[model samples]
Target: MPTPTPWYARIPPPLIMLFAIVVFVAVMTYVLPAGHYERIEVAGRMRVVPGSYGTVDSTPIGILQLFRAFPEGYKVATPIIFICLASALMFAILKATRTIENAVGRLLYKLGTKRAELILVLLTFFYGLLGIMVGYENNIAMIPIGAVVVLALGGDLVLAAGVSAGGMTVAFGLSPINPYTVGIGHEIAELPLFSGAGLRSVLCFGALAITAAFNVRYFRKIRRAPETAIGRGLDERGLALAKPLDEYAVSGRDWLLLALFGDGLAWVLYGVFNLGWFINDISAVFLVVFVVMAACSGLSLSQISAAGMKGIAEMAPATFIIGMAATVKVLLEQGQIQDTISYGLAQALQGLPTYLSAVGMSIGQSGLNLLIPSGSGQALATLPVMIPLGEALGLSRQVSILAFQVGDGVTNLFNPSLGGLVAMLSLCRVPFDRWLRFVLPLTGIILVWAWLGLLVAVAIGYS
Candidate 1:
């Protein structure tokens, strides 16, 4: 076994990426623009610009210079800040009402199963399927509760965490209706919102189905594996970081939750009906829902503000990590890195025939997802390059779409930089090594499922 690094030497993925960005920026000062490159346009649901890069300027200065130019990177990180604040407030409110705990308790009690291994598999399926409708952030909030369920069932904590993490990724990965990232992928690839919906839905459903089957097999092994298989007994130290289950109010909180749920419904309707309310300003919808939750919860303005602040604090680390990720976007934009990657991969697979391009694309997309954890951002960077290549190679737009979704969703299972993944890890106190041991097999299973979906897509006129 590889020796684990000491605590002090363990570097977070965001920090490692940031260091790479700094080095890339420093080097770009000398050899970019003059080197082989392409003019890139970044258009997606979200965009990340390193302050070090000039605003569409033709200047030759390194993007690193822009970092110094804008010292308050927080200004550039506004969305991240808002997201963090909202998550923390949501968590606080959920805790204050004990609604989450009560809900989880009820779920476990109703399960009426003595075999924990069976329940864990079922939980993964439920959560993963629910994710098709809700965002990963919403679904991940329930993971810690899943941990308690696991502990009670005598299953491994790490395995339970994997169930949540892995399940959530498979759900979002295969979702035909991901309003954020998939929407961005469609826009960048110039596919209609309804363009590949049928095939995409099929692929998504297929991935989830296969994921469900594989998790069942894996958890069976987990149930049989001795507790000693886990190096350190599952640590519940971070349970302290979570508000007590009783703190979340359930009865009076229903109205608040219902309102929030309705708000979420309205948001979904706006997407489906193409409502002008959503078209004019989507952010306004999030704000309105937030306010409604406060009002229904009977929270005073001060209490709400305090909750929001707490939520922001909890999410502060994520904010910095996401902001640093923006710097990597800067490097790719300036260096034509996306094009370079696309071209190199395309050339290497040139002799494999057209069907293979879709395969290569799926692999490339999965790999890029590691370096750029955000699906929206990755799609924006790669789709234009990949879609056109796929078209030229006689592949359908649907294949590109399915390929992108599968690639984006699979890597999400363990990427530490992703807000939901990191939050689940923290909330559950599952260490990186432990998370890996449990998830790697499942991830491999999902990867095979992804390719199988791609092959099906090819067979069904997608290629």
Candidate 2:
């Protein structure tokens, strides 16, 4: 008799999982009520009127449109897809030059395995800090570098992805100064911009501590017992084992290339913060970095072209999944139930007590993130109602915003509908099931922290 397939074999791959979900949501388009809300422009976003929801003619997507959503996802997700492909191509060319390998080798030579955990801690904090300051969607290129460093430090790809994406996810959730989420939220809630920074800073620090401690503990665990990691057989820390430290050293050319890489990133950051650059601008910078670095590394033109193609090929799986994830969003919008769901969720909070209402707002936001993953979009749609609802429940608008912050922020860590999360995990070769196993526990703990923080905010009359 043939051997049985493993239990996980029954589960669909990430791409298939997304396809199934998109189909399910497409079906629900017919089943769920269709509605819309009147909107007014505020702070460059369309804010929903608090009491303007009305039933509209049902507009469920047909089978043709359902199939069309996949291609639409590709079109809709193009910007982030560009960023993802660019990062992959750049790293592939960098690998051709052995820059990452030699850099990890030199660092290991100086730090040894025992001391490398510090690098994890610091990188996590650095990423967390950048996210706190810069918001989201600008750091896709940098995460792989952190993952590589972690892989070199004797952890599996899961841990590598964990510390890098994990830290950034946390910071994005609790970002006090983020102009997109918190700033837009503040403007919508009629609060001073960055007004509640003190409490938010504390919340962010406490959450990062929890994340860093949990990940570092796991890092130490697999260090001593590699069998225990979810990625045990799937990943390896071969930087030290691939060759002796003595055999690997950073050259003058590597240093110059490294500096150029830093300059490229600095330029991207400048464009993002100063010039309002986004995906296209950032992708252009990465492409330049790849071409320049490949030239400096002395690869022939054909070799350079091959490396770029190979990088895009390697990234195809993740890139495809990212596009499919967008299909779910497209289907949701196509059905016209997006605002109906938002209206119903808001209506449910009408009679709850102050504390429960605050918590409920966060819960509702988390649920809505499954539908509306964009922070600014969610804020515009939900906060108009949530703020007033919280005020009616004897809760401050600040508490409601905090609830939105935590609810909106933490879900990105593993929300499959959020393309960035799935894309990052796929790039790291972490399966969706394994990612949930690792992140769900932290997600639960962070939700609790969010609840407790909300309670404290209410107790102190936070405004």
Best prediction by lDDT: 2
What are the C-alpha RMSDs, in order, of all predicted structures?
Answer: 6.2, 2.4
Q: Report the lDDT tens digits of candidate 1 across residue range 122-155.
A: 7777777767765665444456566666655555
Per-residue error for 63 in candidate 2, Å, reads: 1.1
Which ten residues in a row are the worst by lDDT in model 1?
Answer: 48-57
**What is candidate 2's local distance difference test score?**
0.81
Strongest candidate by TM-score: 2
lDDT by residue (103-216, candidate 2, tens digit) is 877887787777777877887898888778655667777776776777777788888778878888888888878776788878988889989899988888888888888789
lDDT of 1: 0.60
Q: Residue 425 in model 1: shift from native, Å?
A: 3.4
TM agreement with the true structure for every prediction = 0.72, 0.94
Off by over 4 Å in 1: 1-14, 17-77, 115-119, 136-157, 179-192, 195-199, 213-313, 334-340, 343-349, 416-420
lDDT of residue 65 for candidate 2: 88
